[model samples]
Target: MSGGPGPGRWLTDRLSTLLVVRMALERTGAPRTAVAGALRWMSPAGWAAAAAGLPATVAGRHLGWAELVVAGAALLAVLAAALVFTVGRQPYGVDLRLSSARVVVGERAVGAVVVRNTAARPVLPARVELPVGTAEVAFPLPGLPRGGEHEEVFAIPTARRAVIPVGPVRSVRGDPLGLVRRAVSWTQVHELYVHPRTVGLASGAAGLLHDLEGRPSSDITASDLSFHALREYIAGDDRRHVHWRSSARTGTLMVRQFEETRRSQVVVALSRHEADYGDPAELELAVSAAASLGLESFLEEKDLTALTTHEVLPAVSRGALLDALTRLETAGGPRGFVAMARAVSRDLPHASLVVLVCGSGVPVRDLRAAGAVLPAGLRAVAVRAHVQDEGVASVGGLTVVTVAELDRLPRLLRRAVR
Candidate 1:
């Protein structure tokens, strides 16, 4: 046997023994009811006297009434002190504050939790637990002064894009004797929304034709003049193109051939309608195609605008247009493709390209009705599955591109514009 116990070993052993005794008492019928009955049967002094008399009875030794009275008084004093400490020593309040209630993806977010001592006396908190997403963290508060606050910062991880929910913090206070612990829960909730990541594409889509052009070929034609490039004049070239300034410096003539700038303007219409399970994939493909076309046009420096039935209209700029598309990914509502197209045609310039990205379930009559209102030169391309009968033959002098044949959109667009 060991001659002496290690630090805190004696205290630990005492607590273990007390727990076992408490559990044993509890298992014998209803311990709480029994304790209540015991308390009712005798006064504190009478209970103390009974406890003091038990030792002598077990030892079969004679004990005087005066000695028993003194022993009982001493035991009562200790019990009274324990009752006071158990009730008045524990601390019981917690508060949490986040630097920002909302956060974006890939951003560093921080929060602080404050533990307060509501009791009049000091308390040693065993542990405080905070819930974050699918995990939980526990922190220790060795000692907290009465009416004082302890603050700690917690870091939020940025591994994925999503909405994260934080907390209903919990605090646990253990008895000084380490035999009993009390737990309390707090109500606090925080929300964070993570945005999507975007990568820029270097290739331009200016040369690619859009179905909204209402033309038949992908070749570039010389109808409109937009500045293309300046090059050195070659042999057999017209001398009228010679630049006197350039001849004076390098003795070379620089001629400018303005590249034909197409008059085609593109309008991308995104339907905000909710699709059924069978058509969700098709709908997503349509949306991606529309976004790709819009981005390509913007990069090529083509005039383009995007509209959604869900209250988003991005200017012709690439960034603003992309942001609109990103929002369209989670949009919900009824199909406003026909109505949106009619509005765009009426408000925008004539001969513009109207590209409608819609689900397969739109009524063909609505498409035909919209087609009648569009300008003579304006072209439309409706994207949907072939299964859903969109009875639309031609809308606003535009052509419909079935879901199965969507791959030919680039070529179709070039022809439409020509």
Candidate 2:
């Protein structure tokens, strides 16, 4: 009286079978989707032919129709022939190597793909496809005998700063009718970082001070090297810091107080909001300017923290900083300079100098608000990227400078700091 299996039970059984098949495939050095992807090898035309011809052939035989059967048989035969094109085994060993993984914008990125035949027999001519960023490139690979190889060298033009994905070399086989198609990936994807072009800035530019002993602040501490004053010793005060001579003179326990000294740290925050810039090129200029500042700070042996709209970038080394910058993109939302400044103030409260890099579209009011959020006694400077000659001005205690090119950054920064 029970049905063969309930719908839920049938689905569960099918899922269990799929999981077992996936595990088996994975254990054999094949991906779990190998079978599923194989099923999708049929092109749209092949699917359409199968969908119509199979039904037509079955119904034609049942209804005793000669023309329908003939048409269906011909369609099925075409599909079968197309399937033969994808039946052969592909014995390919692919190696994708790049000349360099990092380069400045407008430089050429070179790479080569080498394909070798691993099987004892010869490999038929085929097409190799490589996906670079959003585009796919194809190279014709000639037939190769056993132990034979072929190499294809390519160059990628880097017109703008970005992190471009290079490839996963894949071999594609398809029938001329576009009925059946098969692709097998042979190499993993690689990243090419087109870094922003940064100009050389003089050491200690932007008034960045380098001091191993640290700069003195207004905050008073009981255990620092910079002496500030002496106060009556509290019960919890360290006895080592107590001035015994002064205590004897005043007939009371006196402890020495010192001004807190912090190592010079520069925080460079580049705005990544799309609306903050008048044009796309402005943002690029701003990025280059920020990179210059960060590099200069590193060269001068100072602590540096680089930031953008949403996240903090690694500033441990110049290469790491530039790599992070290459991957940066503008935010679609309203997040801008003000948000980055607030982050610097909150997360990097001890920063001595805060450089806000943005485009000319940012309003003066926003710059003032950004400077206002920073901690007191911190030097705040804003660089507004533009397409015209550079200029400098002061707005609401914030030093605002407009830079049109990378070479003008140093002069603009010098003027702002002075």
Candidate 3:
């Protein structure tokens, strides 16, 4: 440092170099970013052609070879032509509408896409892409004049229950060789719910002592619908509940002492762990069974709580319940149904009845364990979704049934209750 320059001079020199580099980058930053974006649009073949053509063109001019120059020039011309297809900005207005946002598993999800030209001039024909779940469907859109509209109706296949994403409809522009491509999305994504099939249950199929008035519990209350024993009137007791006949007989003011009445609240827990099902289709059967039970409770205006092994589903309304079921997915690993039952017992201590939905492959020991974890005296039913062996049996303080079909669910429940 002493031979070349002082320490201060060396520091100044380093600062000057950094400043020069920063100025250079600031001047070229936009152009570099633009070039990088353009490179992203180039396909593999286009990149290869450019890679070879640039070198060949420079070598040909230095070596005085005309053939090399002509070959490189032709290759570059093809690229330039492909680039023309992607040069313009897309001028389009699109609206995606679904015939019905929700449908059953076997039903079709019908939708229509209306596209209009928003520019003053005619727009060229393009390919429109619609992403449906993991797959994409393409439609050929004809050229439209200014202010013209085009409508295309399509149906999505719904072979099973699921929430399928059906859009973010995008228009694609590319050359025949696919050297350069551009796409612009026109609409937001929409969800199509394919709900599980459900079967109606008998009025008294499931719940705790099904009574239209209300089921009576051990806890006594001052005023309720169900009639209980009368007690000496408390200081704050309402005068309307004064039992005149009881008071006259007992020679004292006695108010109606009533048991706490509560409406039937049902809890349905569907086991989604992979180990519970021998075949993947068995999980579907389990879901249908659970859905049927929950939907029945929902339609009857019974308080319902539906859950899977991993998460809880909406049970507020019929549509919300079905929509949540459509989005349910199975989990992997060695988890058992006992966790779900324990959760029901913990979270919904006042639940009147608990329905355990599981596949046939679930061990009987696990089912017994699941029932054991519930609160004492809580009514429990285990619905084992079986492929063929369908019947009803009794476990320790728990009723167990095997259902082979959705139509058999109501009958199975009736049998379990009996």
Candidate 4:
């Protein structure tokens, strides 16, 4: 969100820059393979020792012969160990396992890596580097005898909601001299989803249901099952549906009228376009809103359908919904929210309700227009994920709620029923 775009895109862009640098090194005959990959870097101690030894080796000849001999020997020893460390084969059969792949904000999670020595002889101590998002952690491994395994546990950060890439663990090997280092990646990449915090809307379920089901709109016609009221019989009216009491009293026929009713289904249309979200805070708020509202709808057992700029998320169960929401990142889609609205209008014309969770950059007029495009009698509610002093209001004839955060959504939802 800060550098280029979303986290994934920013990571890709950063890695591209690193790749360009590595490619230049490879062009100059640097090794790109694991055996002699250029991923290695000299530690501070290595650089300092080399710099000191070079001058001592040069000036010691004129100053003192003993100084010259000692400095040259130390330099040779350091270089010899560095070369040996670079040539040494890394420990094999390393495996990384995580406690869980999905969690909420402020929760704790752990990752364990098992280092195995499959060589015939004892494997020397080595270093392990694990990638977590844009950062890496390096820890030391104890020497392991052949066929022995050692496991190390590390804490994963869950201070915020994000999809943290956990692994592709790399093993580092270097001598005590800290001269040349070699790293070989052994494990595959795994992602952890730190979902945003959400509040349960269990108490507000009735309000949501009433809005979805209770209506006296003329836009909806009576189906065979849902009865409304009786009115004077019109031409070609079915006599079988005529009311005998009203006809006998007034000498006029009255037919039974009904209001159309279908199985209650709610569509949650979330705008995930990066432009729509505007900023990181707005993006997070928008996602939280979607999650909370969708969960409440699902808890109420209404047929819930979730739509994003990318596609419709599976709402079959809570697990599926949370997983889908956790993976929802901002994107710059080719089409905007209007396109998504059109899609919903055309495909879900019979949906009893539609909720649009928009971001900061989205205009209220545009959302109102989007809601206006829905089929007749299909109520539309717009929720803006932005900082606001007022909780709810009407905009452009469409009901809109401006929420500063996700926790206020339930109150506004309940109030909407009034």
Candidate 5:
């Protein structure tokens, strides 16, 4: 029993082995760093002296001066390396905030990142990286005392309509003299919506409503808002709508005839293919035009569906329309814009009005073909956004409007068929 290993000794041995193993792994992972730091701390000259004095120390000469120095240096390096790798927390945490979730192109939006050092102990300075779309911004953070905080403001670019990914701030820490480095992510990613710039216009310009009452139908109904003509009152005719003066003058029971008023639907089909707009400006204008029409449709509280090259977005609310517009990219897949437009138009034959916004690069013949595919009695309008200014015209049974600039979208949209 006396010769056997004690429980305390066994536990100490296990802990020591684990510590050694962990240190070894860290050193191996940072070989260049460890070597560089060791060189700076203990020079080649010092190493040579340590090696030279090793045999003398073994012989019990001069009380092992060089050996003691080398051991102390090695222990210092191990402790430093361990500390460098294990401090994973930053003094401050970051909260990302944007002034507005939705903004128009060419408009400025401000964002603030609130960094707070809520730790109980003073923390070392660190570096933070914030991702903005394709760009990365680096911030050199200053060391903060306990419970200290700072706020930083940044500008978000709205040159184009898009949903930009903003954050997931990352903190980086490292030794001063090429020793060790570590990185940790602090926040979640956020999206900033940049909506297309548009102009205010009447819903009638989009052909959604022919008149105040609505689109008229050939089918006659017993009772309706739109007046058609006066006729002799039948047995089932409601007396409330009887034309009393006309009945007295004619000595007969007469009732006002009315046509059926149908609620109109406006569908905006926009070409999202890059090929459709060879010029970037044209594409931007096209987006602006579509956005304007969609806005009008929403403002008027009419049934509206915004269509891209291949997808359909129902503009149920202003937020939903803007969200879809923000996320719509230039490329719309392989089916191509013309074909997709025709297919969509054909499927929505019942729609009262359909508006197509495309880049200038699209051919007039193709636009005509797209219009021809629409269901009978459905009206269609085409808007071509381009750099070369052109007047409005009608080709192949569809009215085409030309928009040279985004600012003139309202004026040009007024010329559209009602």
Candidate 6:
């Protein structure tokens, strides 16, 4: 005898059909109770009896009242349980919080989220979806207690400076039977900032500036209140500095020689105009050269200033100068080299050393135009590379040094300063 159908396969097929019908009803926003009621009356027995009624011989006796009633009652009980579970499940919500809204580049930052069950009963959220930039992390909140909170820490990458916005964490709650799921969004926003990276060159490279020009090679030049060195009194020596105490003790006139101290002012200007090579690498090289020169000058105890075309005032301190260089790496505008040079010249101290870091092929006319306006006694050095012109010569009152490679910058700078 051939069996009509396997019980397991029959149940699976019926479940699939019921699922399809439920989805169709849901799409049309039909009442779930009405759909459930219709499904309860559509039992296997009803289908079988309907088929039997189609045959001519069994048309009159195919279906009986008892079997239809029993099968219909059983389906109604199953559907009643499903409906109770679906409507009785609790709802959940999530909220995210951040410690700080703004942060500096290269600094660590933190973010936390709290999950709460707003419904009267507890809910076991099966999964949670978070929009965490380029990647999604799904959390399993299987036993989320009512009004409970969960916290997590994520590392923020700050290789560059920018503003970042972080989420409205979404909570996904599933029914106990896993037959239905619901999602809810929370109102939560966070902002993070990454501060710039700074290098400490004050103490690391302090000794590299010994024996430089324009300053006496003594660290304690300013501490001359104490006796420094005894020397023969020469004409025009200060009368107050006759050293009478020392002269009387030694039976001879003596004079005190104080340490010599002088201040050297240095002005560093960067050409912000687009390079001839049409590449950013050359611009970066120019910025790095400017920074290196400023730091070196400061290390030598010289008052250093960094100027760009867009700004009227130049940066004075080493840190401020470096920040200015960072800004120049991203700045774009028309060629204002002559304007910047003239501006710097007006404000620069007399007898200062002016260093111009520019790309090659800059109109010699522009350099000559600015040089004509420079203050008298100011020594100017122009650091230019072959990036624009193949053959170049020295400009008026300026020493022209060309760089064919980036590695030669340090050497070129050393020569220019000397």
TM-score for each candidate, following the candidate numbering: 0.41, 0.79, 0.89, 0.69, 0.70, 0.45
User: Candidate 3 — worst ten consecutive residues by lDDT sum?
Assistant: 204-213
Q: lDDT (CA) for every model shown?
A: 0.59, 0.87, 0.84, 0.78, 0.75, 0.60
Give candidate 5's error at residue 370 in angstroms. Answer: 1.9
- After superposition, the stretches of candidate 2 with alpha carbons farther than 4 Å from their true spots are 1-38, 55-68, 203-214, 218-260
Task: Specify the poorest-scoring 10-residue window by lDDT in model 2.
Answer: 204-213
Candidate closer to the true structure by lDDT (higher is better), 2 or 6: 2
Please report how far candidate 5 places residue 44 from its true position, in Å.
25
Maximum-lDDT candidate? 2
- Candidate 5: tens digits of C-alpha lDDT, residues 1-418: 3587889999999999999999898878788786665454433444454455454445443475676656655645554664454355555677988898778888889888777888999878877778999998778777788888877788988888888999888777765543445566778898988988877776336343534237778778868888899989889888999999999999999998889887777888888887788687888788778888888877776778888876887587888887887777788455365676676666775677778888877887887787677776667778898888766888787788887876776666566653
Task: Note the residue pairs that clash in candidate 5.
Answer: none
Q: Give the TM-score ranking, best first.
A: 3, 2, 5, 4, 6, 1
Off by over 4 Å in 4: 1-78, 119-121, 146-148, 210-261, 332-335
lDDT of 4 by residue, 1-418 (tens): 4564788988999999999998898886534464344334566776676777777777777687886868766885686667677676775898899899888988998999998998988988888999988898888888889898989899888887778998899988877766767778898999988887788876653676655654334443534666788889889877888899988999998888877656778888898888886678887787888888888787777889998877989989877887788888887755377778788989987788888888768877687677677776667778788865337677654577778867777788777656
List the lowest-lDDT window of 10 residues for candidate 6: 198-207
lDDT of 4 at 3: 61
Query: What TM-score should be assigned to candidate 1?
Result: 0.41
CA error at residue 76 for candidate 1, angstroms? 21
Query: Residue 224 in model 2: shift from native, Å?
Result: 7.9
Clashes of 1: 15
Which stretches in model 5 have alpha-carbon errors above 4 Å?
1-88, 177-179, 202-213, 218-223, 226-260, 332-338, 416-418
Off by over 4 Å in 3: 1-33, 203-213, 229-236, 244-254
Which of the two, 4 or 5, has more lDDT?
4
